[model samples]
Target: MFLPNPDAEFTGSYERCGLTLKEYQELIKLSLDSRTFLVKQSKQSAFAKLDLYGFKDEMVFLSGSSDNIELLHEIMADYGEDVNQWYQPFTSRIRHIRAMKSQSQYHTQTQTDVFEIA
Candidate 1:
Protein backbone atom coordinates (compact mmCIF):
# COMPACT_ATOMS: atom_id res chain seq x y z
CA MET A 1 0.00 0.00 0.00
CA PHE A 2 1.13 3.56 -0.58
CA LEU A 3 2.16 4.72 2.86
CA PRO A 4 2.80 8.13 4.48
CA ASN A 5 -0.85 8.53 5.36
CA PRO A 6 -2.38 6.23 2.80
CA ASP A 7 -5.67 7.14 4.45
CA ALA A 8 -5.84 10.37 2.48
CA GLU A 9 -9.28 10.65 0.88
CA PHE A 10 -9.17 10.38 -2.94
CA THR A 11 -11.66 10.01 -5.74
CA GLY A 12 -11.89 6.71 -7.60
CA SER A 13 -12.62 8.31 -10.95
CA TYR A 14 -9.90 8.14 -13.59
CA GLU A 15 -11.43 10.98 -15.56
CA ARG A 16 -9.78 13.48 -13.26
CA CYS A 17 -6.98 11.28 -12.10
CA GLY A 18 -3.35 12.29 -12.03
CA LEU A 19 -0.54 11.62 -14.50
CA THR A 20 3.15 11.36 -14.00
CA LEU A 21 5.31 14.26 -15.07
CA LYS A 22 6.72 12.18 -17.89
CA GLU A 23 3.25 11.15 -19.04
CA TYR A 24 2.22 14.77 -19.10
CA GLN A 25 5.28 15.63 -21.15
CA GLU A 26 4.56 12.85 -23.58
CA LEU A 27 0.99 14.05 -23.87
CA ILE A 28 2.25 17.50 -24.71
CA LYS A 29 4.63 16.20 -27.36
CA LEU A 30 1.86 14.17 -28.89
CA SER A 31 -0.53 17.11 -28.85
CA LEU A 32 2.05 19.37 -30.44
CA ASP A 33 2.36 16.80 -33.18
CA SER A 34 -1.45 16.65 -33.48
CA ARG A 35 -1.70 13.07 -32.28
CA THR A 36 -4.04 11.47 -29.77
CA PHE A 37 -2.69 9.49 -26.87
CA LEU A 38 -4.51 7.16 -24.51
CA VAL A 39 -3.70 6.19 -20.97
CA LYS A 40 -4.49 3.07 -18.96
CA GLN A 41 -7.09 4.47 -16.61
CA SER A 42 -10.11 2.26 -17.09
CA LYS A 43 -9.75 0.54 -13.72
CA GLN A 44 -11.26 2.01 -10.59
CA SER A 45 -9.21 4.78 -9.01
CA ALA A 46 -8.23 2.71 -5.95
CA PHE A 47 -7.23 -0.30 -8.02
CA ALA A 48 -5.74 1.81 -10.78
CA LYS A 49 -3.47 3.51 -8.32
CA LEU A 50 -2.09 0.15 -7.39
CA ASP A 51 -1.92 -0.97 -11.00
CA LEU A 52 -0.25 2.17 -12.27
CA TYR A 53 2.40 2.25 -9.61
CA GLY A 54 2.62 -1.51 -9.54
CA PHE A 55 3.67 -1.39 -13.17
CA LYS A 56 6.46 1.07 -12.27
CA ASP A 57 4.58 4.05 -13.64
CA GLU A 58 4.50 7.37 -11.82
CA MET A 59 1.28 9.36 -11.36
CA VAL A 60 0.66 13.05 -11.16
CA PHE A 61 -2.66 14.55 -10.06
CA LEU A 62 -2.76 17.49 -12.48
CA SER A 63 -6.37 18.55 -12.00
CA GLY A 64 -5.15 21.71 -10.33
CA SER A 65 -4.25 22.95 -13.79
CA SER A 66 -7.38 21.62 -15.46
CA ASP A 67 -8.32 25.17 -16.39
CA ASN A 68 -6.02 24.76 -19.37
CA ILE A 69 -7.49 22.40 -21.94
CA GLU A 70 -4.01 21.21 -22.86
CA LEU A 71 -3.26 20.41 -19.23
CA LEU A 72 -6.60 18.68 -18.66
CA HIS A 73 -6.29 16.37 -21.67
CA GLU A 74 -2.64 15.90 -20.96
CA ILE A 75 -3.33 14.12 -17.68
CA MET A 76 -6.79 12.71 -18.27
CA ALA A 77 -6.46 9.07 -19.26
CA ASP A 78 -10.13 8.25 -19.52
CA TYR A 79 -13.62 9.71 -19.62
CA GLY A 80 -14.48 7.70 -16.50
CA GLU A 81 -16.83 4.72 -16.38
CA ASP A 82 -19.12 6.31 -13.80
CA VAL A 83 -20.28 9.70 -12.61
CA ASN A 84 -17.64 12.11 -11.54
CA GLN A 85 -16.55 11.99 -7.93
CA TRP A 86 -15.30 14.78 -5.67
CA TYR A 87 -11.86 16.09 -6.50
CA GLN A 88 -9.07 14.53 -4.47
CA PRO A 89 -5.91 16.28 -3.37
CA PHE A 90 -2.68 15.15 -5.00
CA THR A 91 -1.10 14.29 -1.64
CA SER A 92 1.98 13.08 -3.59
CA ARG A 93 2.99 9.69 -2.19
CA ILE A 94 4.60 7.80 -5.08
CA ARG A 95 7.54 6.53 -3.07
CA HIS A 96 5.72 4.26 -0.64
CA ILE A 97 4.04 1.79 -3.00
CA ARG A 98 5.56 -1.65 -2.73
CA ALA A 99 4.87 -5.38 -3.09
CA MET A 100 4.15 -6.93 0.26
CA LYS A 101 2.32 -10.01 1.58
CA SER A 102 0.21 -8.40 4.31
CA GLN A 103 -0.54 -5.09 5.94
CA SER A 104 -1.90 -3.85 9.28
CA GLN A 105 -1.95 -0.92 11.63
CA TYR A 106 1.73 -0.41 12.18
CA HIS A 107 4.38 2.30 12.11
CA THR A 108 7.91 2.46 10.79
CA GLN A 109 10.97 4.20 12.19
CA THR A 110 11.43 7.77 11.12
CA GLN A 111 15.16 7.36 11.19
CA THR A 112 17.59 4.54 11.69
CA ASP A 113 19.59 6.36 14.36
CA VAL A 114 16.69 8.08 16.08
CA PHE A 115 13.00 7.18 16.39
CA GLU A 116 10.05 9.44 17.04
CA ILE A 117 8.32 8.40 20.21
CA ALA A 118 4.75 9.45 19.86
Candidate 2:
Protein backbone atom coordinates (compact mmCIF):
# COMPACT_ATOMS: atom_id res chain seq x y z
CA MET A 1 0.00 0.00 0.00
CA PHE A 2 2.98 2.25 0.15
CA LEU A 3 3.93 4.32 -2.88
CA PRO A 4 6.42 7.05 -3.52
CA ASN A 5 5.02 10.56 -3.44
CA PRO A 6 4.17 12.09 -6.80
CA ASP A 7 7.12 14.48 -6.44
CA ALA A 8 9.54 11.79 -5.33
CA GLU A 9 12.12 10.30 -7.69
CA PHE A 10 11.50 6.78 -8.98
CA THR A 11 13.80 4.31 -7.24
CA GLY A 12 12.86 1.47 -9.66
CA SER A 13 11.35 -0.62 -6.90
CA TYR A 14 8.80 -0.29 -4.09
CA GLU A 15 10.77 -0.93 -0.91
CA ARG A 16 7.75 -1.59 1.33
CA CYS A 17 6.38 -4.42 -0.81
CA GLY A 18 9.48 -5.52 -2.70
CA LEU A 19 7.83 -5.03 -6.07
CA THR A 20 9.65 -3.52 -9.00
CA LEU A 21 7.98 -0.77 -10.98
CA LYS A 22 7.26 -3.17 -13.81
CA GLU A 23 5.74 -5.68 -11.42
CA TYR A 24 3.51 -3.03 -9.85
CA GLN A 25 2.23 -1.98 -13.25
CA GLU A 26 1.59 -5.60 -14.15
CA LEU A 27 -0.32 -6.09 -10.91
CA ILE A 28 -2.58 -3.15 -11.66
CA LYS A 29 -3.22 -4.33 -15.22
CA LEU A 30 -4.05 -7.83 -14.05
CA SER A 31 -6.32 -6.49 -11.30
CA LEU A 32 -8.25 -4.31 -13.74
CA ASP A 33 -8.65 -7.21 -16.17
CA SER A 34 -9.79 -9.52 -13.42
CA ARG A 35 -12.18 -6.89 -12.09
CA THR A 36 -13.85 -6.66 -15.46
CA PHE A 37 -14.43 -10.40 -15.52
CA LEU A 38 -15.65 -10.48 -11.93
CA VAL A 39 -18.07 -7.61 -12.50
CA LYS A 40 -19.61 -9.46 -15.40
CA GLN A 41 -19.92 -12.65 -13.42
CA SER A 42 -21.34 -10.85 -10.39
CA LYS A 43 -24.02 -9.37 -12.59
CA GLN A 44 -25.00 -12.82 -13.81
CA SER A 45 -24.90 -14.56 -10.45
CA ALA A 46 -27.60 -13.83 -7.90
CA PHE A 47 -25.54 -14.75 -4.86
CA ALA A 48 -22.45 -12.75 -5.68
CA LYS A 49 -22.08 -9.00 -5.24
CA LEU A 50 -19.13 -6.78 -5.96
CA ASP A 51 -18.64 -3.07 -5.43
CA LEU A 52 -15.75 -1.14 -6.88
CA TYR A 53 -14.44 1.96 -5.19
CA GLY A 54 -12.42 3.55 -7.94
CA PHE A 55 -8.77 4.31 -7.53
CA LYS A 56 -7.86 7.22 -5.36
CA ASP A 57 -4.29 8.38 -5.14
CA GLU A 58 -2.29 5.13 -5.39
CA MET A 59 -4.87 2.51 -4.47
CA VAL A 60 -7.83 0.73 -6.01
CA PHE A 61 -10.48 -0.25 -3.47
CA LEU A 62 -13.00 -3.01 -3.89
CA SER A 63 -15.73 -4.09 -1.44
CA GLY A 64 -17.48 -7.44 -1.36
CA SER A 65 -18.51 -10.20 0.96
CA SER A 66 -16.04 -12.91 1.92
CA ASP A 67 -17.41 -15.25 -0.72
CA ASN A 68 -16.99 -12.66 -3.45
CA ILE A 69 -13.52 -11.81 -2.22
CA GLU A 70 -12.57 -15.47 -2.34
CA LEU A 71 -13.89 -15.61 -5.88
CA LEU A 72 -11.62 -12.72 -6.83
CA HIS A 73 -8.61 -14.47 -5.29
CA GLU A 74 -9.46 -17.62 -7.23
CA ILE A 75 -9.62 -15.69 -10.49
CA MET A 76 -6.37 -13.93 -9.73
CA ALA A 77 -4.73 -17.28 -9.00
CA ASP A 78 -5.88 -18.55 -12.38
CA TYR A 79 -3.75 -15.86 -14.04
CA GLY A 80 -0.61 -18.01 -13.32
CA GLU A 81 1.19 -15.92 -10.72
CA ASP A 82 1.53 -16.45 -6.97
CA VAL A 83 -1.44 -14.40 -5.78
CA ASN A 84 -0.14 -14.26 -2.22
CA GLN A 85 2.77 -12.09 -3.29
CA TRP A 86 0.56 -9.73 -5.27
CA TYR A 87 -2.39 -9.55 -2.90
CA GLN A 88 -0.96 -9.73 0.60
CA PRO A 89 -1.51 -6.07 1.38
CA PHE A 90 -5.04 -6.06 0.06
CA THR A 91 -6.03 -9.12 2.07
CA SER A 92 -5.20 -7.28 5.27
CA ARG A 93 -7.38 -4.38 4.20
CA ILE A 94 -10.20 -6.79 3.56
CA ARG A 95 -9.81 -8.22 7.03
CA HIS A 96 -9.96 -4.74 8.49
CA ILE A 97 -13.17 -4.06 6.65
CA ARG A 98 -14.69 -7.30 7.93
CA ALA A 99 -13.77 -6.41 11.49
CA MET A 100 -15.29 -2.96 11.13
CA LYS A 101 -18.50 -4.44 9.79
CA SER A 102 -18.75 -6.86 12.68
CA GLN A 103 -18.13 -4.09 15.19
CA SER A 104 -20.83 -2.00 13.55
CA GLN A 105 -23.29 -4.86 13.83
CA TYR A 106 -22.42 -5.40 17.47
CA HIS A 107 -22.99 -1.74 18.27
CA THR A 108 -26.29 -1.74 16.44
CA GLN A 109 -27.49 -4.78 18.34
CA THR A 110 -26.50 -3.41 21.78
CA GLN A 111 -28.14 -0.03 21.38
CA THR A 112 -28.89 1.80 24.65
CA ASP A 113 -29.80 5.49 24.61
CA VAL A 114 -31.70 6.57 21.54
CA PHE A 115 -32.07 10.15 22.79
CA GLU A 116 -30.09 12.44 25.07
CA ILE A 117 -31.69 13.94 28.16
CA ALA A 118 -30.96 17.58 28.80
Considering every candidate listed, which one attains the maximal TM-score? 2
**Model 2, global lDDT:** 0.47
- List model 2 lDDT by residue over 40-94, tens digit each: 1221311122335554312323335577567457756655456656465555555
* Model 1, span 79-102: residue lDDT tens: 432324211211212222222211
Candidate 1 global lDDT: 0.32
Q: Clash pairs of candidate 1?
A: 18-60, 19-60
After superposing all C-alphas onto the true structure, candidate 1 shows an RMSD in angstroms of 21.0
RMSD, one per candidate, in order:
21.0, 16.8
lDDT of 2 at 91: 56
Q: Which ten residues in a row have the lowest lDDT in candidate 2?
A: 38-47
Worst 10 residues of 1 by lDDT: 85-94
All candidates' TM-scores? Answer: 0.19, 0.28
- lDDT of every predicted structure (CA atoms): 0.32, 0.47
